[model samples]
Target: MSRTFQRALLGLALLGAITTAAAQQYDYDRQEQWQYPAALAQSPIDIQRGVAIDGDLQEVQSIELRDTVATLRIVDNGHAVEVEAHGPDALIRGRHFELMQFHFHAASEHTIDGESFPLEGHFVFKAQDGRLAVVGVMYVEGEANALAGEVLDALGDASEGEIEREDIAIMLPRDKSYHHYLGSLTTPPLTENVEWYVLDTPVTLSADQIAGFNARYSHNNRKVQPLNDRPLVHFAAH
Candidate 1:
């Protein structure tokens, strides 16, 4: 079979599998598909401006990262395209947290001043004490991203498995300033007590790059949850 044709078939098959699984009792739109949605402390919220900046939102001076390659496995859990990678042993807020994996949701989850982006990338982290933290980066449609391009280049076909791109490099944008808030997991279990740091600056990707991802797992983000009187802080990173 041709490469493009194989990809199309794979996408259809994956979608079919997801549908069949739901037949066993699962809601494609709800987390876990078995329990009621949480009323508070949900993630992927609409990050509004002018919110009171309470505590200090600090970051590590640097997180050890490699360039030549970003070792990540592209996984499709019938939801979103996630990347599993070797973690950079990092720390934040005086606690050491390791980068577990990162994933993308087209049409973004969180919004800024009530506006959503074309894409949202979430970096999930965990500490030894079982604490969780996430760094969210929003992406717009424009020029291609150097680091992201490397990952995209690997998607010649829609094969689902661990995808390790040897040429791709891990990078953090120069504009590290971010908004800090407390939220929960956007997916199943709806786990709360996560420290969320959303990068204030957004990255840009070419139109085709955005379309490529959309074609695969088009819109997988959860709805924007309520802030619920929680305090949000902004870090200038001076």
Candidate 2:
């Protein structure tokens, strides 16, 4: 073989090896149906969830929520325990979005000042105008959470069905100070343009509650993605 041809072949081999290595780093089997690591705007970005930043956020707004008890539907999808919630719609930044669903994660997805909590809950919403927003609540090992117990018991049944909605208002922290940003769903299709609001105050869940979730779905958290020049704002609903 000519020296020039040999060099070209060596370069091609190296390129192929690099590509394979990258593909291996992305767990295709573990990704939620359609998540691609190569996609930008992917979620669970590393965040300073409770800290203040200077001029990083473009705008901040208040949240008006109508918390009421309704029927609760739970889905055992194997990846995570999902709950369907219906109540009076919430007003976010002047847009009304219905509370669609909420799901759980072991440990946590977004890092708060580079620290991960014991568990996380994502309350997802969608507006009539086709806008999406999520409110993230972190959980730490402390006292047992009343609402978490209801979720755990429902999950324990190992069946997918609906039950009377146990009012979870007691679980919501009255203080609304939170970290705000724009990001996509942590799960696949990796849809972009979702607004994220991660509350600074963490709720409590007992050892048993955490264990129950872990027993069902050991770990369903998506790895944190790059922030990549995205803005973060500390918001407290007025």
Candidate 3:
């Protein structure tokens, strides 16, 4: 080949390598190496039921869910299925945080006594000051979940649709008991200072419903991080 042609081939090869590297940067396999601040606090920590201290937060923390129909946009964002909307807000330890969006993770991120569930849903809320509070609910294999079914059907097909407020409200456990801690987001940027409430009571979803999500994004969960010296408090349900 001529000198000009040889140089062109080399340039193309370099560009391809760069693109491939950028794509794999956020891949779950490379998560351990992902960069974050020196806070030493990360998320998806295992909830050691035996070590958690009990507390009563029913009065201070509440989830205000509207009883009206709302439009939600569901997207299969290549990584996980995410539903975006507004209205519901949660009060965490007396601080107000608006529900921004929610998404799913397979095999769960947080575990209870080292046990992983079939599926986990994260309800991300944000305060006006930009602080975040996430409520996590685990799904056990049993009766099919209507909301999960609707979200799965919309994935890779429909984007926008109407859903009842009750459907969203049902995702949260009625008991209101949860394990609270300070952690970071499971996804990249892995921002810290996020308040987490992993509900003690898990909801139910059929085997098929869980499989449907797995088929799209089989494993999108980040490995559990160290609990460090952070306190893990279990808020009792009244």
Q: Residue 81 error for model 2, in Å?
A: 0.5
Sorting all predicted structures by lDDT, with the top scorer first, yields 3, 2, 1
TM-score against truth, every candidate: 0.78, 0.79, 0.85
lDDT of 3 at 185: 90
For residues 1-238, what per-residue lDDT tens digits would candidate 1 score against the true structure?
8999999999999999988765433233554453434567778788887884744434443333333354667665566667676645555555677777778888899999999888899888888888988889888887887656655655456555544554323335566677888898877656788889888888888888888778776767788888999888776655
Candidate 3: which stretches are off by over 4 Å?
1-22, 56-69, 156-166
lDDT of 1: 0.72
Q: Which scores higher on TM-score, 2 or 3?
A: 3
Writing each residue's lDDT as its tens digit, candidate 2 over 45-121 gives 77765445643245546666677476788887656788888874677766788988888888799888789987889
Ranking of predictions according to TM-score: 3, 2, 1
TM-score of 1: 0.78
Off by over 4 Å in 2: 1-38, 49-60
Model 1 RMSD, rounded to 1 decimal: 7.7
Any runs in candidate 1 off by more than 4 Å, and if so which? 1-38, 57-70, 161-171
* RMSD for each of the candidates: 7.7, 10.1, 4.0
Identify the leading candidate in terms of lDDT: 3
Give the C-alpha miss distance for residue 40 in model 2, angstroms: 3.0
Q: How big is the positional error of residue 214 in model 2, measured in Å on the Cα after superposition?
A: 0.8
